[model samples]
Target chain A: MLDFSLNKIFVEGNTDQKMIATILEIHYNISFPYNGLALEDCIINCNGWQGLFKQVALKEIYRIESSGKNLIIFDADNTSNLGGYTKRKKEIEVGFAELIKATKKNINYSIYLLPNDSDNGDLESFYMSCIKPDKRFFIECWNNLYGCLQSKNEARYELKIPKSAGMVYSYVDLFENYRTGFYQNKKTKRDYSDDGLWEYNFEENNHLKSLCKFLEDNLNLKSN
Target chain B: MPDQSEFITHFEVSNFKKFDHLVVNDIGQFNLITGDNNVGKTSLLEALSLNLKSNNDLVFKFHSLLCDQHIHHHAENKYSKNPIIPKFNYFNLLKNKEELPLTLVFNSQKVILTDIDYFRLKEEDKDLFVSTPYFMDGIEYKYWIRIDKSNVKPEIQFMYEDDYYREDRKFESKLYKPIVKFRNFYERDLNKFIKELSQIELLNLTAFDYEEIVSIIKIVIIPDIIAINIQKINNDSDEMIFIATKSSKGLFVNVTRFGDGVQKIIRYLIEVYYAKKNGFNYFLIDEIDTGIHFSRLKIFWKEFLMLATKLNIQIFATTHSQECIEAYAQALEELGMEEKGRLIEMEEHNGKVYASTLSYENIKAGLISNTNLRGA
Candidate 1:
């Protein structure tokens, strides 16, 4: 009911939003304008923070007390350098330190980069092996990574992405902009024609409104 | 000691009812004669008035209530350099115990009577001595002393303090009319004599003027309720007034609203004011530590006594509070009033009223040796 001109953030990515919010929420108990919040101000997710720890994002986070909600997130898709040759914890800490330095300017705009670049050296290869570069392909990759990361003891940065992105990401990623596919294990089909989920991808996930409210209310909560 | 400059050095009680053979000497600056409830603290005060000018009927009714017959009240005042001629007087009450021509002599002294004690008095005159002699009952006693000696007059003729304060102030006060001495009646004009007898003014005399101090005390002391308003009134076409406060609803509200500590502080301050304005002369307080919290009791003696000595009011009070005793002792030691003061306690000894002097060490021992404090 009140003016929300400076209240919240609206994220563009699913994994980036949930990972950054869920991680910080669990670790520090510090709430934020999660993925979906009712506000006029702009927002970022996990991918934003680890974006080379860019000076822009850092500046943005710090100005949040005045400017508004500042959220940051990063990609954990590539490097396995997270795990040390002998001492794995050291490698994770050093890697996180580097990422933390990049966004030191804003101080308030905290960053989140997951499944460290050091984790699971080759996730793209594994996800791509099962599914081709089609509509449901990244979805399949999201599901695989999500499930694998669920089992891994890696730092937040090292955790794998969801296989098929838990179907939740289909609403955000543009389906019409790319080709998509789904593996038919029963039919033993390699690439079923017209069986892609390109229509479901990049669609608005309306059911998530309540979920975002839950996140928003749970964190950065306004008390009566 | 130059007779200590007291106007009337001694009193003569004749047919003063129950006071048959009362001869107490050394009328010093502070005389504290205390005993059990009926052991005659009031009787002694009444006998002292025989030397001064006071109402005879009021004095007679006092003896009628005591129901004692024929007591002699004889006294010698320090008006002249002659101890040989004692100023004695006889107030003869008829055999009926009520009717009498209570005649008071100015400078008359029956040297024969002073030389001969009541043990030698004939039974008929002894009958004349007790009854119609001195007032004995508590209420029938009115303080209207007519001073015969000008320069040697009794500044404060006589006073009687009943144990009326503790026993339901509203109900028990009806036991008798409390002593409110009229200045003109007692040969003391209120405005003129006040300059001599007045003690140090606590803060300011006017309650309105003292609002600042009272308010500060209210703040730091945190009283449950505080009121400081002064009103001037006409008494018998003369100005008179009293200062009081609704202070609080009661102790219960104070404890919940502000704290027990604050209530305690306010109480101590009022008591200190009482002691300061009264002078180091005569104080008859029944219970010294009522509503006084234990934690703040220490301040009562340590700081309060310092103020008390300068005001010079000889404090005579009773206390069921062991802390009171302890505080008085500590106060005496700190203020060095121990050597200058006396503590007389009334206790029953073998069914007879007995009194004994208590020193600072005794007070300390009484406090420290109590079984309760040992465990605490």
Candidate 2:
């Protein structure tokens, strides 16, 4: 069972959960199954933005009586019709305010919009930015093919999938020959952090550094 | 149905069993209390029952019931055959031995229960207690039950102030007259069930009430039950409840032969019908889902809430089943009377018990989001 008594990080999807868990483990040497049953216990996947907002509105985030930290991570999804970083943050703040009013517990929590909190994109945007400079050609080639398909109006027919997920899948497949889609099947799902294909050079990427700082300030080691 | 305006809207308990101080506000017509084990859910029901303004005999009866003491009836005294003297340790009711009095407040009416040592009183004072009514000024009309150290049995007495007339004197001072019906989980008294059945027959209920009761029983208990009858056997020595189902043909089968779930639901519905006919406005049930099957919980809650609304009775029931809580929320939504139900989550923190009242909106949100509202 998930140990809700400890600190928690509520993410939008399973990929986000994997990504955050990987970032914490790689950067800070933090490990999973932190006082819980498995690696994904501390970081909960709310399934989607709707599920996350529903949890907030239901005051579920304040269910436990712990002074541990809580981090909420969701994609800005700026490319879609959904709102960007500022708007998503504000929506969460409003829902969180209502929850606080209902529960009245002193919760230590913070919100981080995906792709460096201020970007108008998601975890895919962050991962694309963190790719090794030498390995950038793989994503660039995929993007060029994607643009050609869009010019011929064959993008929907040929790709018919999320562009970022396709780019990540193709990039990882080029080196590992995994041939599997990103987050397609649970049994053969890829671990974004454990995979050595992606180069998360935090020293070179300021956006990644900012996220690490935010995590370092919020995710305490005492809970683990 | 009784007037709905007179129900208790709020209650507070101080120094009661398992609660140093607990306050539950915004009480609705239907309340489902939930918590972890030993969190005092049943004690809250007992506190509510004891807070009711009842006569001395009824008060002692409630005390005995709370203490789990069996009252013995003697054939020698006809009028007072069943003398309910509290036979348990009185200190068990207190939160601590030093906490002098346990106070229960229902709305504005307050009941203070204090235990006094019988051996501490002066000899003259003891002689006065055995004689005529002991009158004193500014006594505050408390139920002073003194327990003898040697026997550990309480001597029940009621003291009044000087201005109170002898004819106007009674136990508990008649602050609130709402009749309370309590049902426990373990004890299924067949004699009490038969008594309630006779009372329901004497109530002369209308056809609609009888039909509603029968339909509720059919929906929640046995779907094949066609008719119910009470028969006396062994030369009127005992009464038995018999039911005729579709499978039973024209003959009636004794209810004792069926499973406990059927008998429990029947006894509960009959008692509730009788209490409603007699103008009862409050019902407290401990472990309300004990004998019933899990699959029948939704229908049971639906029918139970409908009956409570029709009878205008405020219900306070404790539950350990998550399905029961979910069923209650669903039933409230199905009836479109979401405002009438509340879930009181009792929790213990730092040696004090607290209750968090969740409205229908909160409960629905939690249920939809799959949140743990049972405080487990």
The local lDDT score (0 to 100) that residue A82 gets in candidate 1 is 42
Worst 10 residues of 1 chain B by lDDT: B156-165
Candidate 1 on A1-224: residue-level lDDT in tens? 22122333323243334433442344335344423331112233212212322222222221332443333323343324443223433433454466346434223332222222233312122223223234445555666666667678468677545433334334223343333544345232222122242121112332222233343443454322
- Writing each residue's lDDT as its tens digit, candidate 2 over B135-232 gives 32213223233322334443332221211234433332222222233343223466555644454354355667657767888898878878776676
Candidate 1 per-residue lDDT, tens place, B306-360, comes to 4445445433444455565565556567666666444444333233332334334
**Each model's TM-score, in the order given?**
0.29, 0.71
- CA error at residue B151 for candidate 1, angstroms: 40
True contacts kept of each: 0.00, 0.03
Winning model by lDDT:
2
Check candidate 2 and list the clashing pairs: none
Best by DockQ: 2
